[model samples]
Target: MVRYIETVLVPYTDKVKEELDLPIRQQSIAIFDVFRAHRCQEVLDALSKARIQHVFVPAGCTGELQPMDLSVNGELKAAMKNEFMNWYADMVAEDLKDSSTINKVDLRLSVLKPLHAKWLSKVFHDFEVKERHYLARDTGSSAIHQDRGINIEPHVFELYIDLMCQFKPNEVLNYIKMNEGYRLEQTLQICRKYKLSEATAFLLEKAGDIQGAFGIILQKLQAKLKLFVDVMQGGNTDKDLNVLFLEIDTLAIVIIQLCQRNSGKMDEASREALWFPLLETVMTPQRKLKDIDNKDVLDDFNKLTHHILNSMMGYIALPAILQKIMQDPAYNTGKFGEVRELILGMLETYNYEQTLMKTCKNLLNHDIHVHLKSLTSAAVRGYIPRGDNCNLCNKLFINQNETDSVVVFRCGHSYHLPCLRSVGSVHVMDGEEMWACYLCSHSKRGRIQSTRFHRSLSNPNQAALQQTKEKSKEMTLDSQHIQAIDAVRKAMKTPSRMAILTELSRSDTRSVRGSSGIFHQENFQLRLAPPIAPTNS
Candidate 1:
């Protein structure tokens, strides 16, 4: 299981200890789980003697390195199993025909081949099973759980991509378990949002078994869009996704070949045949954001070209364009502009800013920043986060920011209060209807009656309903108070339970001033009955 690179072993074999200088005292190293079982006691002793740090992992889980282990691995395993069965049947037939002439080599071949085949199958099976389970676990663990409502963080895009890219598919798959069955949709959403039809087609190709899988699904979409777009365009230029399917297939083949070369399976000449041309064709300086002209196919490639190169290399592989946007400032700055314009456009078109601004003054004034343009595009198109700019704006704010008159929502939208009030009146003639946020239009407000009833609730600094000793004894049980406590107990049932309970509690206590009288959480304000005259009494 110890998967040392061929080059690493070569140094030891050639006795070039000096040339192969490995760090004697490294702080950290990340090894795939494939090699964990090979960690011998001697290595452990060496670690102890040198005071070096190391970690161990289980086997049969190196999905990133093994392409067969990605979506295609399952089918490959079944194919291997089928091959084994057929081979076994042939061996049985041969042995039955000539039992007396059966040799030890024949027996060994019969036994060993199936065992090896089974071994390979099991490796992939373990990966598939664990991956499926991990997704389930992650879905349940996410902040978007029922009790917590929704947590719309802009940083999630970055976090998800970081985790997914650094780890193998199985390693990162757990992070998006709830989104497992919806991968194709999510992938398409990202591409469509970013206008990355090329990337979308590439991803769909890798999710194999076209007859039942993405190929057919996307074809159906292509057909549907053809009808929709052709009618609108009057048949001028309505290209369907199927037109690009062949190109996508060709790209995937090139990628697999590139991976084979990288893995050292290809001869040097063959490697040169593929690598030299590709590198020469696509490589470009960080400054030039786009390709200017067309030359030989092997001419210098730019960001978009490199992105295609990576996709042609592997579905899960991170394109240089994406990586640059994530890390390199030269590229990230450019990418940020694209993201900013996209956000502004989405907000303007959907009137998101107006809706979110109704909630608080803070949201109205805050600036927003977005990253991972590819992923964000998907989120916007699919409404995955159901709203945009939530996480981006939060990260944009810091202690130095002076926007005290603001509030943010779960979907990462923000708004200002004073600007919101001038736009519309907060009115509720009766108690049944939920109040509306004419500003953000996110959700109808819960019944908040008698707005002026609880002054303490408006300001977090104030204490509402002080528990004096005299009143504490008489107020043994307020039904509403008891209900509030009971709800909290229910919320504590899970880790996310407290968030729901806290919101409910806030709703119960909150009140606002209205045109008629004091308001309470139930959406009604009370005008105290006029006091009777002392003489009359």
Candidate 2:
């Protein structure tokens, strides 16, 4: 180092000082990285003899502390990128010009090594040193001269894409995901055109277009172009692949959510109607289906139809899955084909139906027994007939005439014997006439009318949708809602409660029942206060 400095530094400093004749410092300043070799005694002695005062830059702060480190960045990188691109193009062109030898991996590597070597070589054979500053500025050895304008690497995006095409795609995908400098739209378009679905999915998800990414993955799976595991792989497992794994999970969930949201927009009928065709499409083995594993043809139409009807989704409707598809787990999802949706729909529907059935069972076991016992007890104990008129025909009871005497229910409702016979509501129970009051049945629960069960046969889904909307509108609970509830509580206590039940408006009965649900833990918890046991007298 001493011999090199004596040979290079002394001559350069002396020539600049003597010839340039500019404002000169007493001693030159030298900067070096904080390394032992660069700050050794020998180096200090050499610097002192050369009249150069040395400053050692702190570790990892060279960019801030050293002028050369700062100057070397930005512009130099862009120039290197441009040089690499130019070298690549020249190599390809030269290969084309030569005899048609395939540009193998070794050939490409040889071309790349030479280009890198050229960049690393510091012997600048061509140097333009201006002895005089154009502006007549006094000279400093490291004074600003070159403008060092921003280096523009022409077509860097395209060049980078070409590199991706030539190199390991997994590494390139990692770069594309992390680098914010990419023009995302252009990158996305190129990825699509190249059929790089994996990269395209990552870009789409990163851009917050998760639906698009999901569709891309599904398409790849549906087309049998890639397996789910293959699509999920962001890179080799030896690296951090958590982000990629999470991305696949998110994509799978998109379909499930879409299934739920879209299904919600339609009613039961529309859901059922739309489902059959989709199911049929899945069942109809395509000409391509036979190609897979060399399966037999599905030409027997009757057998196919029977198969459809008996399939898991078909039997229950999965008795019915349009609901199950929405809740299906996405992690186990691997492939997409005609049957995946069909099978999932069936299973999901079965699950939903199973849930509903179980709920109904729970409701029956816990809720209905109390009501049945109460009704039986009410019938046995009996209530007085207070009304003077027949509840059914609205005619005054003829107490003096046997033919038209009012037939009174022990439960307070009165109907003319002729009206009762006409409706055939009367039945012999325990050697006495018995009948269910139309009003009582209604207040107890909604009537089991065909209209209630069938909804609108002509347009059930639309009818259900409208019903759902109407139902949703009534969900608000305000003071009036509270007051109406309070009125029901007051009615249950009134001496005229059961008798006036038939007279209560439909709105009142519905309002009373609305706050009341079968699932209430305290459904029949009516009493003035806690019961007190009586002592035997």
Candidate 3:
């Protein structure tokens, strides 16, 4: 049946279509709790095709899919309550019609269908909201304002400001508003005339608004492009180039957007300072720079590194070298206020602090212990693949006599069963007649296949079978002798046990020296008395 959803959602909906929300607007989102659970490959493939970027919610948070879990669970209970009442009413009506009949079937149908529909609707809506809340912003640009006189009209300025404002509220409200006497129009003019480099510096030092700094950079890039165009057309401007402005602007924009997307992560500010110099080196004319000795820059570099460590917490183990550097009290505590401030600024740009906080709590509450148990369970299922080929040897034995028989190993690698069985008797560990892997020494551990050389060994004719059984018995006897030898070698380590065993071996009665009727001293004396003469008489 075609179900009409009032909004765009269904159970196991497409991810790209679902999570259109951005800046993590919802307190919770309903994604599959485990990425590997429930048609995840199909969903993930769809997301990849749709170019949807995502941060996986930490495990155990599906119960917290924002408002859905909170509100929908209660709604389900209420629906159940209503269903019960309705069912009761239906039963009463049926009883009135016929006092003897329970009318069980109709009563059940009345209560169940509506309640199920209601609960399903709640779940669908909850997921739909989560999807819609995460869609990326519209990225197409509509116009370019490239005038260079610094006195463009106010209305145009407001329109551009409004448009930019929609994308970056925190940036504008928290930083841009602080710059007085410099309207957006003037910033644009400065960008057109001085190149984005000079203008970005002017804005950063003068206006302190990062957005304004970007505005200047954007104009300078446009001017540089125009300059390039003019030169290609056989004309060159005498104006000196200010290339660093464009470079700084590009890097700054990327960093700022990262900050915006991550909800003012705590480490972003510091990282940005570090990121600028590295990015500048890429664009600078010299192509290399002297070692960065700026204390503020160094601190920011460390902060950026730490932030990356937090962001990729699920994957790489942070390098010990970096961790060691970061943990030093002198490095952390001796910094200037601006250096410290830069480091702290990064925290404002992303939620790394929150993630760390959550992790710390899990550690404290023995969540790690539970996690370790789960890991051990998963480990038992299989080894984590190192992206290498199967390491076990593939060779299998084929008994010359048996064509049909094959032996299997416990590890699932297969060999000719008949050949393997001929080599080793049935292992008592598992009922299967199997052979040990020569490499791993695990008998009955892998799958065994029949080989060409061993057709007769597998034959079940009485003569062949009897012969095979006799051979097996002989092998068992030999194996027992080997085991006995091994046991003797083990026992020989103790001098007293070895002495008792040696004396026992010397006599026909097969009794130890102390336990037999003849005492050791008496037997020796009788041997010396020449008892053979009395026997002849």
Who is ahead in TM-score, 2 or 3?
2
Q: Best-fitting candidate, measured by TM-score?
A: 2
What does the lDDT read for residue 482 in candidate 1? 45
CA lDDT, candidate 2, residue 413: 87
lDDT ranking, high to low = 2, 3, 1
> What range of 10 consecutive residues in model 1 has the weakest lDDT sum?
388-397
Q: Where in model 1 is the C-alpha error above 4 Å?
A: 1-45, 52-90, 93-122, 142-186, 189-537
Error of 3 at 254 (Å): 11
Instruction: Name model 2 segments beyond 4 Å from true.
Output: 1-168, 171-195, 202-215, 222-356, 359-361, 364-537
Per-residue lDDT of model 3, residues 368-455, tens digit only: 7888898898667743322221222122233354344333344554444433454453466666533465335533456433211121
Tens-digit lDDT track for model 2 on 376-483?
887788456878776654545654533555566656888766555544466799999776665566557765321111121234455457556556333334454345
Clashes of each: 49, 8, 57
User: TM-score rank, highest first?
Assistant: 2, 1, 3
The estimated TM-scores of all candidates read 0.19, 0.26, 0.17
